[model samples]
Target: MEMFRGFLFISIAMILFSLNLSNVEGRIHYHKKQKKGSPVEPPTYAPSPDDPVSQSPSYPPPVSQSPSYPPPVSQSPNDPPAVPSNPSDPGNTTSEDCVFDVMAFGAVGDGCTDDSAAFAAAWKEACAVESGVVWAPSNLTFLITSTIFSGPCKPGLVFQVDGVLMPPNGPDNWPKTDSKKQWLVFYRLDDMTLTGSGTIEGNGDQWWELPCKPHRGPNGSTKPGPCDSPAMIRFFMSSNLVVSGLRIQNSPMFHMKFDGCEGVLIEKLSISSPKLSPNTDGIHIENTKSVGIYDSVIANGDDCISIGPGCSNVNIEGVTCGPSHGISIGSLGVHNSQACVSNVTVRNAIIKNSDNGVRIKTWQGGAGSVTGISFENVQMDNVRNCVIIDQYYCSTKACQNETSGVYVTDVSYKNIKGTYDVRNPPIHFACSDTVPCTNITMSEVELLPEEGELVDDPFCWNAYGIQETVTIPPIDCLQDGGPEAIGESGTYGCY
Candidate 1:
């Protein structure tokens, strides 16, 4: 029995020893695996939190704590902890919304002629802006002559002309493209804005067309025609330009012309014209795209709005037109010319006391296409011819071959409400006899005369190039005016 008891004790002791050895071996294997490919190798010793050294590319075991462990560095006088030097940074990473005072930026505080020099300096400071704003504070009248300021406008260089920019009023002393008004013209620039509640007084007495009616010219020489002159504002090959909150008046020619621009927003503007001036249109856009003219008032002698050839995606909304020839599309081309006008929308516009409204005037003969046009929700008061589309559009200027071979196609006129006068008919739809109007659809045309005399002068010329059946309603409201309608003799005569 004693021998058996000793054997049992020896066996138990052996089992216990085996279990302890297994635990030791497993721990060692696990620790080796953890250290083999871990992102954070267990440091031989914990490092101090104050240590400035970063992880070295050489992932060797750290040596003894030494001063060299920290990166060799120095402090810069101008350098901040976290900022960049380029002040015009788009992100404003430096957070420098330049707090420069107007006068400090070369703005003349006094209302005088010396403002030209100050304006020149202010413009220079605004040129190199990635996102910079230049101020033109109040209480200053800046007189500018012919000054040309070239522009490849940076993302955020603004001309905050808070004061008046008076345009010199003389042909010899006027601000021409070579001289003045070039102050803020941008060429092929993106994301630029000119916003202010100031005025651009052309003081256009000298610029106005002196009577060329066989009378002495500016040099006291004989000249032809009624007058010889053009407008004030001229833009060439610019993009993403915004003109807002401005009042421009007394323009010699067309008030505003946007030539070869894309993405233009003209809003909250009041443009006027001298009622006696001839051929003075409100706005003329040529070869432009994605343009919007909204919430503005235009009063001029000629057409309130004229869309030249090569314009697309244009929108005119919430506009008030008066003392003008009304809205027109194309005088097309003179001869042997090509034009493409498409994708235009005019809505919610008011036409008052004008010769015509919602008009599309193309030459009788020319090569052009006007498509995807819409005129909706229009109101006209005391309008001579509320809606006029003259394809054989012979202007006051002499005719060439009777027609210019231009074509008008794809148009719509909906919800046009107006009161026709006695002398002038409410609707006159005259398409070209050769190049007909195609896909021209009109609906909800309410033209009832307020005058008593109802004479019937209804006419519809053939739509030359179309196969669809064209129809003219027999309302007889187009030809004869009501009793109260004015006399109709010449272009402006209301009989």
Candidate 2:
């Protein structure tokens, strides 16, 4: 009985040992499978609070947490990000709100009604904005009296005209309270642009017929009266201005004038008047600098382009002038005031049937100097005195000759070829005896008589220069050496 009991105990012990060994083997196999499949499965445990890489948001969050994530779409890498279309933003101001129409300001577009008040209202609103346009609608004519468009306005201001602008009909209709010196004056403006396909008509027929005009009286006599005719348009003390694409006609006096201005540009303009009209200069500039006038046409009685005192750095190109006094430097130093001009260039011009071509005239007893002037590639047709410099320019028949005069130096003429009137010499250089002209250069000049044969030789008095090539009607009269010492006129400098 003891032996049987011992056998039972041994069997039970063996069975229990076998079961324990099987459980250990199964745990080892499960661990091996988990190690092999680790890369494909998500993490089963949370990260520690101190792990910086696990806390960072650079990686994508879970789908339920990331509500603002954009959908996958194809786009260029360089393209800008999309923005909302918000009209209330200052940068997105609409064009309709920026345009200030004159009609909206209670302007009557009829030919007779006065529209100065409406124009002033429009200008006030437009000038107040950051970038504004003052618009004159099409198919209308607005009569404006002598008015001033004053400004120190915001930048990017534009005055756009698509219609006609007319002044009072004649001197009879002119308002007595208005000043007759200027009409349509623009003052104290910067970065302003005046552009239009329009007409500015100055009804000056009666003003021109006044007896005070030169040679208008019987037998060319002067009738004593206060003769004040208004300039059509004048710009004063303005900078960085542009005027383009307009037609101006029939001015009482000067068509357009610029005074005390800088950085001015004028292009593609047309100016016309009767050839016999008095004091109707097309474009005049005084005390102005850094100016450019290009691609324009002028047919007027007086000078096409006049450069007055204190002007420098002027450039004129591609201009056509007819029936007018061709481009003149000055009737400077009137009443013996100081005048200085320098660095002027005129190129690629045509002067046809004009009174003079490329002239420099100064009154006697004038101070200061004119230097660094050039005229190149000019064509003249039936012009009188194709190239001239007259130091003794006087309006009256009898004038006193003074010892002091403006010094003229460094003038050049190149490639000037054309026909000239036979009544006067093609080239006349009547320089001041006291302040002789110096450094006058000429090249490739060929001027032939328009009517008869060439009867007169080129005239020169106290002018010195060299000719690079043989000229027609050879100018042997020019002195070969430098100018003589300046006479009693004291040394002058730019003011």
RMSD of each: 19.8, 22.8
| Model 1 lDDT tens row, 274-326 | 65556677888998877777778988778888999878777788899997888
> Clash pairs of candidate 2?
none
Per-residue alpha-carbon lDDT of candidate 2 for residues 1-495, written as tens digits (9 for 90 to 100): 999999999999999999999998878843333220011221122333233322112211111000122212111122222211111122222244556767767677788989999789888887888556676665789899999999998775667676799899888889999998899998998877676677889887788888999898889976878789999999999887777778899999999999999877777889999999999999999999877787899999999999999998787888999899999999887788788988888888999999999999999989888888889999999999999999999998887988888888889899999999988899999998889988899999999999877557999999999998998879999999785577646247763
Give the residue spans of candidate 1 off by over 4 A. Answer: 1-102, 105-114, 175-184, 213-230, 402-404, 453-458, 464-495
- Candidate 1 versus truth, CA RMSD in Å, comes to 19.8
Q: How high is the CA lDDT of each candidate model? A: 0.59, 0.80
TM-score, each model?
0.68, 0.80
Output the lDDT of residue 26, model 2: 75
Worst 10 residues of 2 by lDDT: 59-68
Pick the TM-score winner.
2
